[model samples]
Target chain A: MWARTEEILPYALLLPSLVFLALLILIPMVQALLLAIQADSGEFTTAYLQRMAVDVNFNDAWRNTLLLIVLIVPLQIVLALAMALLVNSRFKGHQWFLYVYAIPLAISDLAAGILWLAVFTERGYLNTAAQGLGIVDQAKVYLSFENFGGLVAAIVIAESWRATAIVMVILVAGLQLIPRDFFEAADLFGANRLRRTLYVVLPLLRPSLQSALIIRTIFAFQTFAVVLALAGRNMPVIAAEAYSWYANNRDAHLAASYALLLLGLTIVFTFVYLRVLGLREAEVKR
Target chain B: MAGIRMQGIVKTFGKTTAIKEISLEVKDGEFLVLLGPSGCGKTTLLRCIAGLETVDAGRIFIGDRDVTDLPPRHRNIAMVFQSYAVFPHMTVRSNIGFGLRMKRVPKPQLERRVQEGAALLALEPFLDRYPAQLSGGQRQRVAVARALVMDAPVLLMDEPLSNLDALLRLQARADLKRLHREVKRTTVYVTHDQVEAMSMGDRIAVMREGVIEQCEPPMQLYTNPASQFVGGFIGSPPMNFLRGRTKAGAFEGEGFSLPMDGSRVEDGRELLLGIRAEQIRFGERGVPARVQVVEPLGATALVTVLVGKVPVKVDAPVNTTVRPDQNVSLAFEPADIRWMDATTGAALAH
Candidate 1:
């Protein structure tokens, strides 16, 4: 009897979480999948998916979302790597620098968007500084409705600034795991600073880089608040279209379809990142 | 193929000084070992020579070049770390050729040199294996091969074999000595194990605190240590010390007395008599003591005898019969006794 209880104990303890997942996550996911393919009369149809495919904003939303991911992910990785290396160097005041670099992680995505918007607004800090320096005669409209490039740049900068701290934290943890002797060996072998970073540090930091890329890309697929705050309706993203379809147009079916597409893109990118950055069996064991 | 010289090197970390104004010369093509206990600054001195640590007020020279201001890479020196810091993601071949690649050596020449290094270390079979796939000893060989392929003028090793098991350490030690003889690179090795120092060093610098107590050939260090610390550090079952004062042309302690040259010291000066365990023997006439313990080994036994209240150890033949509580006399030649000042721990002139 005791042996049976021991065997069943783990599942018994896990029952609450399993039921919670069923009600909150798994059930919603199944309902969303069904709602995306079902009509109000309870008959199967391709009408909602076809409508989502031909929506006026669909192409623009897909294009903008992909462009943001491409521009923002790599930029954030580079910036985070620099920050992690700087903090890892353990300079006189490196602890302070670490806390300062991580400050953005405490901010919300919408708040970060508004923060950058304050700088790029017509009469904000950038224009004020340019005007005060006599570099420009007037305040430039950097986020004007017609300036698609300006809007995209603004959104990219905001998103990168807001999300880079998490990547830096992960990279810093990875950096600390490497022994100091490796760097010393590289130094003694005549590796310059750049060569050491490129060959030694980067190759050893593969696991961390893989994780940071996957996490940032997945979150990037669901990016909505930052773009909504910065570009408003000027730029359309997949997440923003899903929200609009459900809340404004009262079309839950189309919203579910958009969510399914977002999920598919996340899975594809995650798989690609895994395939590219995966460690071999030997590397993982160490 | 180059000698290292440091002049008046001093290094301090915050309130503590790690290396105090010490200078030494290493001969070209010499195997110099820095031996000391932990925190004794031997590794720090080696780092200064390798350009890994900057000396506060000293100039370092590799061969004839003033390399104090040069980075380690510019100094043309290679070092094997204690951790055997082989790149885990790379195969042994790439690791061995990394330095050559950095120098942009021609492909054929780089491959040839890598092959030569692997052959020297018996790593030809493991060339394509990652460090994680190899054993501890194999990874250590990879580290050595990587440094050797650099063909640097100077080689620095910081306890490179200390992590291996005892049997492997012995084998690796012999292998390293043979490799050194063949390459003859000006090498500086740092370790705390006296056995490693004695067996491998052409010359040993014994350090204490932050200063070198004595720097001499291994046999010289064994037979004639300059200070009490060096004598105590360089031997297995270290040198025995007995505190006493000179009285009536004899050295007298708590439980024993031995005749000495009176003219060499004052009649009442306090001193310490140092003797090795192997140097003392059982005899019919000498200091008398009671046996305390007998530890038997294969060919020899360590007999602990109490002279007065102080226990003294003597290496004896294993077949000899002696038990605890038995009485015995310890004898030694007068010339073998080392006299040291009790307070300062410095050897006193005979």
Candidate 2:
């Protein structure tokens, strides 16, 4: 019944979602910023930020988080790329392989942590298998607090297995968007499989790769319940420490600062991904 | 340049046979156009020779090498796709040099060849640009340049100009002919356009339902089509067919009678009378027909006429004053009439 000029229509239609975003997302972010920087007397202060700096758990959590990202993202990208290529090959029953590969996506992060713990903990499936295979003389406590490297390895394996599916799905969609003729042309030009993947598929899949990297990196930064479920008190990641600060220490200020720091790191990494792999608007049009 | 030879090539996809037992040869340094409609196995046959499609049963030879079982990389043949298939991410120079780069050709030679190809296609100005920045015609030229730089003895093109606008198609067609003349590679080009086949091909192979009906030079194929299908498929304002019966030494239709040789014809037997539009002319004494529609095409006009219920088309000069609905006598020489078996649609011996 009402008509509006073309210039005004899009903004008018976007007004409702903008209002919702301002209320739900912006307000919370502002409140967290306030809580993180303000002292108990409600005065602007850096006391909580300094306290967070001095916290023992903060240093360990920061190091563990960085190490986890360093280990997990590349592992996931490589595994996801391999899985995506395997599915793209249209091997026998590839549709079934897609379903099988996506099974991890249905498993929650906490569930995946517990699932792998059953294999990696002392007297767990991995230990029993190693013992049965005569690779290990006896059952060993692989996830102990003292065995920091082994615990990190266990967490890396679990996180990669659980989250690689998301990246794989993104890569598969990107692979499908590339026209078949490009590969055929490459073949006609005497490119073998490795050369085709390196030259044709990878370069064409830049945008998808950028998105997958940014999303996975942010999700890695926010990783919480998985660390808590697998390591309990033995490992303290930023997210897990933020949880402990709020629940155990009853210090929401420190918790908010930790959360803000995680968000900042996510933004920094996302910026890097965009800078390195982003397709120019003109390039995307091609 | 090397000739291409296929021996009883057969290819099937699922339950549908795309190319059925075809054996064809493109002579060395010859321009051979495979002319056929869509789904007529022309593209599949070309792909088979390029090693893109594996044959179920056949042997393909490029020059002296048997390349039937080799991968496309080993076949040493370049193909220009109908879609142009230019790498959108790469510059025109990189695209043109891609085959050479894959072979690890020294950078100097690759650059020289790429430059030569770009100059040949008049793409030197766009050599640094990506395919997306170029127009459709330019993109197709880049594809052609990419193929040319391969310097392979055999080249395959699948309706490469089909994606261009009408005016661009005309120019691209001329460019392709000039390139063929300069390179003299054994080219197997496929198109559904008869005009392209007629103008560009040194020899044209007309295919239908996966089999080649006739393979000959343009004028020979036009003057003597091997079957009713070839006769109907190869011309504009297509060859007209009138259902009738042969009586004694004359062919009789519903409202007309014409004299013909009856040595192989049975008396009072059903037959089809085929005549080209250009062969018929208006005359004072001939079969009487009323004009229906006239389409003036530059130098000539195609006139449609009705002889009782059967429609007939005659090519006339544009200046001729033949108006619609006017009764006129159309004349054709006895030798111009092609007789076909009414039931089988195969050409009947004269």
Candidate 3:
């Protein structure tokens, strides 16, 4: 009887989570698929998907989404790697630096967007500082629709600032896992600071970097609140368009179609990241 | 091809002084081992010599060149870490060749040197495999191979065998000693294992509380320890220390009195007597003791006897019949006993 209970215990313990997945995720996903591929009469149709394809914001939203990911992911990786290396150095006041750097990780995305909006506004501190520094004659609008580059730059800066902390924290944990003896051995082998980072630290940080890239890339595809708060209708992302379709146009089917496209892109890129940066099981264990 | 000389080396971490003014010299091509318990500043002193730790006050010379202000990369040295810091991502061949590659030794020369190191360490078959695919011993060999490939004049090893199991440790220890002899470089090895120090080092420096208690050849250190700490630390099962006061020409303890060297200590003065476990002989005429435990170790047996409140061990042949709670008599030659200061724990000579 004890052996029988043991055999069934795993399945019994997994039952609640399975039920929750089916109710909350699997069912909703299937419903969204149906809504994307069927009409109101419950007959199969491509009308909603076609409408999504020809939507005015579709191309721009995806283009902007790809641009954000291409620009922000690499920038965040570099910044986070630098931050992690600095914190691991145990410089004076390193504990305070760690706490200060991770403060943004606790900040909500919407709150961060609102906070940056306050900074990049026409009379915000940035322009005020520019004016004070005599780089500009007066406080000028930087987040205006006419200045597309400026708007994208502001969004990139805001997102990079708000999210690099998390990547840095992950990399810091990975760095700590590596034995200090490795660095000392490298030094004894006559590796300079640059060589040590390139040959030892970076190669060893693959697992953490890969995870950070995948997570940040997926989040980049779904950028909405930050975009909406900063650029509103002036700049569009795939998630923002999905929201616009559901809330403004009252078309849940079209919204689900957009959401499916975003999901497809995220899945594709996640696979790319896994294929490019993934380590074998043995490598990670080692 | 060079020796190391450190004069008045000191290192401190914040308020805690890790290494108190240490002066040591390692002759060229000699294998010198720093043997001590954990946190005794052995590793710190080695790191200072490696240029990995900055000395608070001292001068370090590697073959007449002062390296006290230089960084580790400029020290012209190689080191093997206890964790076997072989790069997990690189093949054994690449790991061994890394230092050469950094020095920009042309590819052909680099490959030849790496091959030589691999052959020396018996790692030929595992060259193409990454460190993850190798066993613990093989990984440690890869670390050694990396250090050897550099062809540096000096090598530093920090407890490199403490991670291995007993059998592997013995095997690795023998390999390290053989390799040191073959290379004939000035080597500084740090470990807490006295057996490794005794078997491998040309000279062993026994340390305690950030100071060297005694530095001498292994046999000399074993025979003539400068302090009670070295005597206690350098021997297996440790040296038995009996605390008592000198009365007439004998040292008196709780339940026994042993004849002492007449001029060794002054009468009516407190003193301590140190004797090796193996030095004591079991016979019918000697100090009285009651056997408490007997441990059989292959060819030999260790018998623990209670003399008053003190426990003394006597090594006997395995064939001897000794059991727990048996009455026994133990004795040692007067020349075998070491007299030490009771208050200071320093060895005293007549």
Best by lDDT: 1
lDDT of 2 at B331: 90
- Tell me the lDDT of candidate 2: 0.90
**Global Cα lDDT for candidate 3:** 0.90
Docking outcome class, model 3: medium
My TM-score estimates for the predictions, one after another, are 0.95, 0.96, 0.91
Candidate with better TM-score, 1 vs 2: 2
Report model 1's TM-score to 2 decimal places: 0.95
Runs off by more than 4 Å, candidate 1? A1-23, A40-46
lDDT of 3 by residue, B1-350 (tens): 89999999999999999889999999999999999999999999999999889999999999989999999888889999878899987889989999998888999999999999999999999888888888898999999999988989999999999888999999999999999888998999999999999999999999888899999999989888888899888878888888888898887887778777657466898888888899988888777788999899998998889877789888888877978888888888878888889889999874
Query: lDDT by residue for model 1 over B1-350, one digit each (tens)?
Result: 78999899999888899998889999999999999999999999988888888888889999999999999889989889899889988888999999999888999999999999999999999888788888899989999999998999899999999999999999999999999999999999999999999999999999888898999999988877788899999988788888899999999988788889878798989998888999998899888889999999778999888888877888999987878999888899988988999889899876
lDDT of 2 by residue, B25-144 (tens): 889999999999999999989888888889999899999999999999999899999998888778888999999999999999999999999999999998888788888999999999
Give the per-residue lDDT digits (tens) of candidate 1, residues A65-88: 999999999999999999999999
lDDT of each: 0.91, 0.90, 0.90
Q: How good is the docking of model 2, as DockQ?
A: 0.65
Candidate 2 wrong stretches, greater than 4 Å: A2-24, A281-286
Q: True contacts preserved, each candidate?
A: 0.80, 0.66, 0.75
